[model samples]
Each structure stands twice: as C-alpha cells, then as structure tokens.
Target chain A: MDFIRQVLDRVGDKWSLLVIAALEAGPLRYTDLQRHVPGISQRMLTLTVRQLQQDGLVTRTAYAEVPPRVEYALTSLGRSLHHIVTSLITWVADHHGQIREHRAHTATRP
Target chain B: MDFIRQVLDRVGDKWSLLVIAALEAGPLRYTDLQRHVPGISQRMLTLTVRQLQQDGLVTRTAYAEVPPRVEYALTSLGRSLHHIVTSLITWVADHHGQIREHRAHTATRP
Candidate 1:
C-alpha cells in the first residue's frame, strides 16, 4: 500500500500525467511536449521528465546534429501508466459536468 | 483539458486517493478511515474528507446519537474515481519492483 501510495504521489501529479499523455502517441522533443501539454512551465516539464526517467517510466535520448535534439519516450512501464491515466482522463471528461453541478449546489448552501 | 487537469489535481493527490480507497468497501467513520489508511494524520484526513465532500465525491452524514456519529461514503463520482485509481494502484503493484531497480541503477550513476 505504501509503495502504491508513493507511486501515485509521483505519477499521479498533474504535470506528470500531462507529460505522459503527451508522449503516449510517440516520442516528443521537449519543445513539442511543452506545446502538447498546455500550461506546463519549462521548469516543471524538466523536473517531471527527470522524475519519470528516474522512475524508469521514460527514456531520454539526445541526437548529435548541428542543432542538438533530445526526445522523450515512454518506457514499457510508462506506457502502462499512460493507459491507466488515459482511462482516468476519460472518466473525468465524462463526469466533470456532474462535479460542476455538485459544486454549484454546494456553493448555494449556507 | 484544463478541466481534466483541475480534477486530477484535486482527486489525484496522495491523501485523496488513499481516502477514496479507504471508503470503497463502504461508509466509514472518521476514526475507522484513519485506521484504514496508514500514515494519514488526523488533520490531513479531516481536510481530505472535507475537500472530497466539497467536490461531491464523498458524503458526510452526522447522526445525533449519544456520542454523535459521522460517517463518510463515496458518491457515484467518487466511486468512479476509485475504480480508475484502483487500476492505477494495480499497475503500481505490478511495476514497482522494476521502478526500484531503475532507481537503484540511477543512484549508482555519476
């Protein structure tokens, strides 16, 4: 349970989830990831990718060229997590309106 | 997308996930919930439950008995979130060993 909690604490965060989702279709350069996942600051993206790499959920590769290129792709574990998070995102999409309604109701209460 | 991010930010936190999981079996009093989710301080539990209730993922019922009884149960939205989170937990259980190995390898690098 503790292990699960730690894992959730790491990957279940907003930036991490967005980063993982951005990488799900394929690998992406840092700039591309930033564009794909809106509202993520450069510092937060860097930190999130570093943590995901450390956790073995993402791999970072740099290409040698006139302009350096770096790309991030999901490891198998990351892909697995991506699938679960995608499901969660779908759930949120389906149910957020209800949550909004509830929030409105709560707001009206004394 | 921003809506999903907000929802995830709220319910995807460590304490929130644990609290929702703790209530999945059924309703539980505050003390029972504390016991069910280890490492959660009373203050954190109180805040987490309050936030969940405000989000309409949890319901708090207070009984006017001799000692006063308060119990928490999941709303349908909360239950849906729980199902998704359970999948995430199972994924962590399946892959945490690999993550540990990755962490160990990363630690040894200069």
Candidate 2:
C-alpha cells in the first residue's frame, strides 16, 4: 500500500501525466517532451521525469554522441498506462458539462 | 484538456486517492472520510472533499437534522473510476518487484 500510494502521488501530478502521455508516441529527448507538454518548465520536466524513472514509468537513455544525445520513452508499464491516462482526459472532455453542473449543484447545497 | 488537467492535478494527490477509495463502500460523513484516510489532517480532508465535490468525483448530501448530518458518496462518474484507481493500486502491488528492479537498473547506469 505504501509503495502504491507513493506512485499515485508521483504520477497523479498534472505534469507527470502529461509528460508520460507525451512520450507514448515514441522516444523523445528532454527538449521534445518539454515542447510537447505545453507550459511545462525545464525544471519541472527534469524533476518529473526523474521521479517517473524512479517509479519505473519512464526510461532516460544517454547516447554516446558528441553532443551527448539523450532520449526518453515509456517502459512497457508506462505505455500500458496510456489507455487509462487517455481515458481520463476523454472522460473529462466528454463530461465537462456534467462535471460543471455537478460542481454547481454541490456549491449551492451548503 | 484544461479541465481534465485540472482534475488530475486535484486528485493525483495521495490523500484524494485514499479518501475516494475509502468512500467506495458507502456514504461517509466528513469525519468518516477523515478517519478512513490515515495521515490526513482535518483541514486537508475538508479542502480535498470540497475539491472532489467541485470536480464531481464526490457528492455531499446533508440531512436537515439537529447535528447537521452530512454524507458523501461517489457519483456515477466517481464509481466508474474505482476500476482505474484499483487498477493503479493493483499495478503497484503486482509490479513492485519489477518497478524496483527497473529503478535500480536505471539508477546505476549513470
């Protein structure tokens, strides 16, 4: 439970979800992931990717190229989460109206 | 994207996940939710539930009674997320070994 709770805390962050989803397409360098996930800072992406790597959701690879090329991609576990992550976004888009109404209903109840 | 992103940020927290899971059994009052989720502060639960209520993941109903009885239960959308949340937990439990190994492998590579 502790381990799982830790991961939920790690990935449930908005940046982590978007960052992982951004990499689902294929390997991305740090810069690429930064660009793909709009509004993420270099600092935040570095931190989130490091955390995801610790949690085993992302893999960071360093190439032996002269300029020190590096790339990030989803591990199998990370890719597996694509469905749920995407589902979450899909659910939100589809139900924004219902969600809004639900909130409004609750706000007035008190 | 904006709305969904906001919710993931709201709920990806450890407290929110556990609180929602705690309420899966049935309606819980504010106190009930707090007790069920260990390590939660009184103030955090109040804030989290208010957010969950705003996002429609939780519904709070108050009975017109002497003590101001209130109960919270998962909305339909909230119930739908049980599988996903449970999946996240199950994934962690099932994969803790793999996850640890993956992290170890990455950490030493640098």
Candidate 3:
C-alpha cells in the first residue's frame, strides 16, 4: 500500500499526468512539450519531465547536432498509462458542466 | 480547455482521489474517512471532502441525532469517476516496481 501511495504521489499529480499525456503524440522538444501542456511553467515542466524520465515512464534523448536538439518521449510504460490519463481528461470534459451546476446550486443554499 | 484544466486541478489532486476512493464502499463519517485514507491531515481531508461536495461528486448528510451524525458518500458523478480512480490505483500497483527500478538505475548513472 505504501508503494502504491508513493507511485500515486508521483503520477497522480496533475502536472505529471499532463506532461505524460502531452508526450502521447510522439517525441517533443522541451518547448513543444510546454506548448502542448499549456500553463505549465518552465521550472515545473523541467521537473516533471525529469521525474517522468527517472520513473522510466519517459525518455530524454539528445542529439549531438550543431544545435544540440533534445526530445522527450514516452516509454512503453508511459504509453500504457496513457489510457488512464485520457479517461481522466475525458471525465472532466464530460462532467464539468454538471459539476459547475452543482457548485452554483450549493452556493445558493442556506 | 481552461475549464478542463480547472476541473483537473480539483479532481486530479492526490488527496481528492484518495478521499474519493475511500468513500467507494459506502458512506463514511469524517473520522472514518480519516482512518481510511491514511496520512491525510484533518485540514486536507476536510478541504477535500468539501471541494468534492461542492463539485457535486459527493454528498454530505447530517442526521439529526444525539451526536449529530454526519456522513459522506459518493454521488453518481463521484461513482462515475470511481473507475478512473481505481484504474489510477491499479496502474500504480502494477508498475511501481518498474518505476522504482528505473529510479535506482538513474541514480547510478554517471
């Protein structure tokens, strides 16, 4: 259970999930990843991608080119977790309206 | 997209997910909820439950009795979100070992 909680602490974070989801399309440069997951700050994006790489859910590659390009991509494990991330996003999209209605209703209550 | 991010910020929180999962079996009093989701501070649990209630994902029922019993249970919306929570838990359980291995390997890199 502790191990599960530890892992949850890592991946259950919205930033981590968003970063993982952003890498689903293919490899992305750090800037591309930033654009894909809007509102993520530079520090948080760097930290999130680094953590994902350390967790083996993502990989970071650097090419020894003149410009030295770097890209991040999902490992098989990350891809496996993508469905859950997709479902999470889908769930919010599906229910945010009802949730908003409920919040409004609750606010008007005594 | 902004709405989705806002909802994700709420429900994607680890505390919110843990509290939601803890309430899966049935209604639970505040103290019972604390016990079920280990390591949660009183303040965080209170806040999480309140947010869930306001979002219409949870219901708080107060029974007029000697002790004035209050219980929290998942609304259908919360229940609908339960499977995603379960999947998140299962994903961690399934892959924590690999994650740990990767972390260890990364630590040893030059």
Candidate 4:
C-alpha cells in the first residue's frame, strides 16, 4: 500500500502526466519535449524526465556525435502508463461539462 | 488542451486520489473519511471532499437526526474514476519492483 502510494505520488503529479503524454508518440530531444508539453518550464521538464528515467518509465540516451544528440523515450512501463493517461484525458473530455455545471450550481447554492 | 490539463491538475493530485480511493467502499462520514485515508489532516480532508463535491464526483448527503449525520458517496462520475484509479494502483503493483531496481542501479552509477 505504501509503495503504491509512493508510486502514485510520483506519477500522479500534473507535470508528470503531461510529460508522459508528450512522449507517447515517440522519442524526443530535450527541447522537443519542452515544445510538446506546453507551459512546462525548462527546469521542470529536466526534473520530470529525470524522475521518469529513475522510475524506469523513460530512458535517456545520448548519442556520440558533434553537438551531442540526446533523446527521451518511454520504456514499456511508460508506454503502459500512456494508455491510462489517455483514458484520463478522454474521461475529462467526456465529463468536464458535467463538472462545470455542478460547480456553477454549487457556487449558487445557499 | 488547457482544460484537460486543469482537470488533470485537480484529479491527479496525491490527496485527491487517496480520498477518492477511500470513498470507493461506500459512503463515509467526515471522520470515517479521515480515518480511511490515512495521513490526511482534518483541514485537507475537508478541502478535498469539498472539491470532489464541486466536481460532481461525490455527493454529500445530510440526514436530519440527532447531532445531524452527513455522508459522502461517489457519484457515477466518481465511480468511473475509481476504475481508472484501481488500474493505476494495479499497474504500480505490477511494476514497482522494476522501478525500484532501476532506481537502485541509477543511484549506484558513476
């Protein structure tokens, strides 16, 4: 249970989800990752990917080349997580209106 | 995209996930909720429930009786979310060992 909670704490954060979703299509360079996940600061992206790598959900590879080429890609575990993240986004798309309506009604209640 | 991110921010937080999971069994009184989701402070539990209620994911019912009785139950929306949450925990259970091993290896790397 504690382990599950710790994992949740790592994966359930907003930035982590966004980062995971951004990497769903394929591997990306660091700058490309930032571009894919809008509004993420450089520092946050660095930290988020580092944590994902540490968790084995992502892999960072640096190719031997001039100017140093590096890429980030989801491991099998991270790809599995992509399915859940997509479902979550789909759920939000389907029900956000209901939630908004409820919030408005709640705001007006006595 | 922004709306999805905002919704993710609300539902993806650590305490929110724990609170939602705690309510999975059935309706719980405020005190019971606190007890069920270990480590949650009274103030946080109150705030978490209020947010869930506003989102229409939870329904709070107050029964007029001695000292008044209030209970919180998952709405259909919340129940649907429960399925996702369960999947997340299951995923964690399945893969945490891989993550831990990766972390240990990463820690030892030069």
Among these predictions, the greatest TM-score belongs to: 1
Candidate 4 global TM-score: 0.92
Candidate 2 residue B27 C-alpha distance from true site, Å: 1.2
Models 1 onward score TM values of: 0.95, 0.83, 0.93, 0.92
Query: For model 1, which pairs clash?
Result: none
Give the whole-model CA lDDT for all candidates, comma-separated: 0.87, 0.78, 0.91, 0.87
Tens-digit lDDT track of model 2 for B14-100: 777787788889998888778888778898888888888887888889999997999999988788777666665555667777777
The interface root-mean-square deviation of each model, in the order shown, is 1.5, 2.3, 1.5, 1.6
Off by over 4 Å in 3: none
lDDT: the better of candidates 3 and 4 = 3
Q: Report the lDDT of model 2 for residue B33.
A: 79
Candidate 2 clashing pairs, residues 3+ apart or interchain: none
When just chain B is superposed on the true chain B, each candidate scores a TM-score of: 0.93, 0.79, 0.95, 0.88
Clash tally, candidates in order: 0, 0, 0, 0
What is the DockQ (computed on Cα atoms) for candidate 3? Answer: 0.75
Candidate 2 local distance difference test against the native: 0.78
lDDT (Cα, tens digit) per residue for candidate 1, span B1-110? 77768987887787888888889999999999999989889899999998889889999999999899999999988987888877877787788899889988999999
Considering only chain B, what TM-score does candidate 2 achieve? 0.79
True contacts kept of each: 0.83, 0.62, 0.86, 0.86
Candidate 2: residue A34 lDDT (0-100):
89
lDDT of 2 by residue, A1-110 (tens): 56666666776677987887788789999888888988887898889999888878888899999999999999898887777776655555677777778777867876
Backbone clashes in model 3, listed as residue pairs:
none
